[model samples]
Target: MTYDTVAETDPAVARALEGERERQNGTLSMIASENHVSEAVMEAQSSELTNNYAEGYPGSRYYGGCRYADEVEQLAIDRAKELWGADHVNVQPHSGSQANMGVYLAVLDPGDKILSLDLTHGGHLSHGHPANFAGQVYDVEQYEVDPETGYLDYEGLRETAEEFDPDVVVSGYSAYPREVDFERIQAAADAVDAYHLADIAHITGLVAAGVHESPVGVADFVTGSTHKTIRAGRGGIIMTSDEYADAIDKAVFPGTQGGPAMHNVAGKAVGFGEALQPEFTEYAEQTVANAKALGERLRSHGLELVSGGTDNHLVLVDLRSSHPDTTGKDVEEALEEAGIVLNANTVPGETRSAFNPSGIRAGTPALTARGFGENACREVADLIVDVIDDPDDEAVVAAVGERVTELTDEYTLYE
Candidate 1:
C-alpha cells in the first residue's frame, strides 16, 4: 500500500492518501454503507485495466484491445451470478445509483410512475428523491414505515400501489434495520401490474452468504453496491431474468454510462472469488451477530432502537425519545471526536431537518472486517453511549478515543 511513486509525482495528493489510510487504521468505521475491502481487492482496483475501453459485452466489444477487459468482466459476471443466483448480471455500472438508472431506462417511459419508500424513511435518493434524475424524469409517489413499529407497512404499501398504479415499485432501503419480505412487495407489484426492483445495496454479502433472505427470484429486477456488505470494490451491479438481458445491457452501456470501469470490474472479480470461500459465510454471520450485540447494549443504555433491534448488519437509533435535546449530528460529531465513526441519519417519522436529523445509524460490517466479534462490539457500544451521554465532556471523549485506539491496534486493518 506504499505510495512512493505518488509521493515523488505529487506530494500533496500522496499526503492526503496517506492521511486517509491513517484515519481508517486509527478509528472505527461504523457507517452502514461502508466496509473495508481486502488488499487483494484494492490491488485489483488499481490494476492496469483502467486504461481499457471495453464499450460492450464480452466477445462483442467496440474496441480492439479488450481481450483482458472482456476476461475480467466475464469473470465478475460469472462470479456474481453464482453468488446471487441471478439469471443475468451486469457488472459495469459505476455505482448503485447508476444501476437503478439503467433499470429505469430499460423499462419505463419518460413520465412513467414510480412508487417507492420515502427517502427519510430509509429509501435511497435514486429511488425517487426530488433532486435526483429519477424524480425529475418520472412521476413519483412514496410509501412509509409504520410510525409506531418502525417497520415497513406492507399492507399500506399494497393499498398505495393499488391506488397509485405505478409503473415500477422500488423496494430495499439505505438505513432500515429489519429484513425485507420481497415476496410481499412482489405480490403488491403483481396486483398492480408493476415491475418490482429490490435494491440490496447494503445487504448484498449478507444475502449471498444466506444470512438474509434474498430477493433474486422473487423480485423482477435486483440491484446492489459492490462495496457495502459485499466488501468488493466500489461499483454497482444489476441483475435480471434472461428475458430482460438485452434490454438491461443496452440501457447500461449507451443509455446511462460510457466505457465501463474495467479496473473496478477486476476488483469485483477478485472480491467475488473471495466471497465464494467458506470463511466469508462466517464473516457475514459474525457481522449480523455483532450488530445485534451492539444494538442490545445501546438499548440497555436507554437508546431507542428502530424496529426494537436489528435483523441485519445495521441498527438505527432514534434519539428523540431518549435525548430530546440532542440531534443526530451532535452524536455523530462527538463520536468522530472519540475516534468512533458513524453517521447522523433520518428516522422514520423525522421531525428534524435532513442535515441534522433525529437519529444515528451504525453497522458492524467494517468492525467485523477488522476481526471484531460480539463482545468487542458490545464494548464499543458502551463507549458510544458514554459519548452520547456527555458529548461536551472532554474527559469522556478522550477516554473513549484512547479505548478506540487500543481496539484498532488489537484488530489492525490494511497492514
Candidate 2:
C-alpha cells in the first residue's frame, strides 16, 4: 500500500522536518545562487512527478505512461519560449554548469579555442577556470576587468578576441556588480567571428522581468539557472535561435544528459508563469534598489565597494579598504555568527589569495523578496560592518545578530 503524509504518520520524520524549518528560519541566506521559491513552485517540485522515469523528451520518450510528464514538460518549454522570445527552449540540464557544457558539446571540438572572463575579474568557473572541464577540454583564454574602472574591459575583450580568435566568446559573471554591455560584446564577437554565449544564470529573472536586457535574440546562445533570481525549482535551461535549435537539442539529450527532471520542469513552468506577471517586473526593480541602498550604506561606513557601487542586485565589498588587517573569511565567519550569510569573493587586483580573498559578495534578491527595502538594508549594512570591524567584540556581534533577527523576522518568506 501507500503511506500517508510523512509528517503525520512518522514521528521521527516529523521532528526532522521541524528541525529543518527552524534552521531556515534562524539563518540568513544571502548566497547569490540561492533563493526561496514560492509555495506553488515548492508544491510542484515535491509532487509525484519525482517518482517518474520518463527517459526522453515529451513525445519521443523511451518509456510509456508519460502523458502527464509530456504535458508538464511541454508547458515549461512553451512558457520559456514565450517569456524570452527564444526559438527553442530546453529545460532538461540539471544545473547551470550542465547547461554550459551542453553548449560546448553543441558547437566546439575538444581542442577548439574559447575566450571568457577571468574568475577573479567576475567570470564563472564553468566559463574557463583552469580547474574546470572547460579549461581541460579546450584552449581557454581569459579577459580581465578594467584595471582602473573594475568594470568589463570591452576594448581589451576586443583585442583578445581578435588576437586569440576563439571559436566561442562567453559572456556572464558571478561577482560582477554592474549592467553588462551586451551590444558591445555582440560587436566584439562579430569582429572575430566567434559565437557569443551569454550565460545569464544570475540575471535571468531580471532579464525576464525586463529590468535587464534580454540576450535571447542577440546572443548566439543563452543559458540560465531556473532557481537563483527566478525563484523557481533547481534546474537549468538552454535557449537559442531557430538555426541552432537542432544542435542545442541534440547536445542536451544524447550529448550531455539523458532524461529531464520532470518535477523541476513543472516548477519551472509555474515560475515562468509568475515571471510573466507585471509584479515580477516590480520585484526585479526593487532588488536593484535594495542592492544600491545596501551598497551606499556600506560605503558610508568607510568600506570601499567594487566599481564604487552596484548597478544591479549584487554588491562586492572590498574589505581591505576598511579592514586591511582582516580577510574575507574573517568577515563571512563574523557575519554567520551574527545570523547573516554571504560569500567571500575575489576582487580585481586583490593582493590576497582566493581562499581568503579581499571581498564579500552579497545580494538583495532574497532579502527584497522577503519585503526588505532600502532602510532595512541600511540597518543590515550597519550590522555587517560592525561584525567585520569588531570581530573580537562578542557583545557587539551578539547585539547586531539580535537586531538582524528582529528586522528579518518582520518580513516573512515562504513557509
Candidate 3:
C-alpha cells in the first residue's frame, strides 16, 4: 500500500493519498454504503488491467489482446453467479445507478410508468427522484413506509400499483432498517403486470451470505452495488434470469455504457472469491449483530430509530422526536469533528431540506470490517449520543474525539 513510486513522480498527489490513508486509519467509518476492501481486492483493482478495453463480454470481444480481460471478467461473473445464485450476472455497469439504467433500457420505453419507494422514506435517486434521469425520462409514482410503523406498507403498495399500473415496481431501499418481503412486492407487480426490480444495493453481502432474504428468485431483475456490504470493488451488478441475459448485456454495452473497467472487474473477482469463504458469512452476521446492538443502545438513549431497530447492517435515526431542534447536519459535522463519520439523511415525512434533513443513518459494515463487535458498537453508540446531546460543546467534542482515537487505534484498519 506504499506510495513510494507515486511519490517519486508526483509528490503533491502522493501526500494527499498518504493523508487520506492516515485519515481513514484515524476515524470510524460508520457510513452504511462504505466498507474497506481487502488488500487483495485493492491490488487487483490496481492491476495493469486498467489499460484494457474489452468492450464486450468474455469470449466475444470488439478488440484484440483481450485474452486476460476475458479471463478476469469471466472469473468475476462466475463468482458472482455462485455468490447470489443468479441465472445470469452482469458485472459491467459502472455503478448501481447505471445498472438500473441498463435494466430500464432493456424493457421500458421512455415515459413508461415506474413505481418505487419515496426517497424521503429510504429510496435511492435512481429509483426516480425528480433530479435523476430516471425521473425525467419515466412516468413515476411513489410508495411509502407506514408513518406509524416506519415499515413498508405492502398492502398500500398493492393498492398504488393497482391504480398506477406502472411498467415496473421497484423494491429495495437506501436507509430502511428492516428486511424486505420481496414476494409481497412481486405479487404487487404481478397484479399490474409490471416488472419487479429489487435493488439490493446496500445489503449485497447480507443477501449473499443468507443473513438476509434474497430477491434473486422473486424479482424479475435484481441490481446492487459491488462495494457496499459485499466489500467488493467499486462497481454495479445486475442479476436476471437467462430469459433477459442477452437484452441486459446489450443494454449495458451499446445502450448505456461502453468499454467496462477491466481493473474493477478484476477487483470484483478477487472480492467475490473472498466472499465465498465461510469467514464472509461470519462477517455478514457480525455486521447485523453490531447494527442491532448499536440501534438498541441508541434507542435506550431515547433516540427515535426509523423502524425502532434493525434486521440488517444499518439503522436510521429520525432526530425530530427526540432532538427536535437539532438537524442531521449538526450531528454529522459534530461527529466528524469527534472522528466518527456517517451521513445526515432524510427520513419519512420529511419537513426539512434534503441537504440538512431530520435524520442520521449509521451502519456497522465498515466498523465490522474493522473487527468491531456488539460491545464496541454499543460503546460507539454512547459516544454518538454524547455528541448529539451537546454538539456545540467544544469540551464534550474533544473528550469524545479522544475516545474515538482510542477506539480507532484499538481496531486498527488497513495496516
Q: All models: lDDT? A: 0.96, 0.88, 0.96
lDDT of 1 by residue, 1-415 (tens): 9999999999999999999999999999999999999999999999999888889899998999998888899999999999999999999999999999999999999999999999999999999999999999999999999999989999999999999999999999999999999999999999999999999999999999999999999998999999999999899999999999999999999999999999999999999999999999999999999999999999999999999999999999999988999999999999999999999999998999999999999999999999999999999999999999998899999999999999999999986
- Residue-wise lDDT of candidate 3 within 1-415, one digit each (tens)? 9999999999999999999999999999999999999999999999999999999999999999999999999999999999999999999999999999999999999999999999999999999999999999999999999999999999999999999999999999999999999999999999999999999999999999999999998999999999999999899999999999999999999799999999999998999999999999999999999999999999999999987899999999999989999999999999999999999999999999999999999999999999999999999999999999999999999999999999999999887
How does candidate 1 score on lDDT? 0.96
For each candidate, give its TM-score against the true structure: 0.99, 0.96, 0.99
Q: What is the lDDT of candidate 3?
A: 0.96
C-alpha positional error of residue 210 in candidate 2 after TM-score superposition, expressed in Å = 0.8
For candidate 2, list the clashing residue pairs, or say none: none
TM-score of 3: 0.99
Relative to the unseen true structure, what is the C-alpha lDDT of residue 387 in candidate 3, on a scale of 0 to 100?
Answer: 98
Evaluate model 1: give its TM-score.
0.99
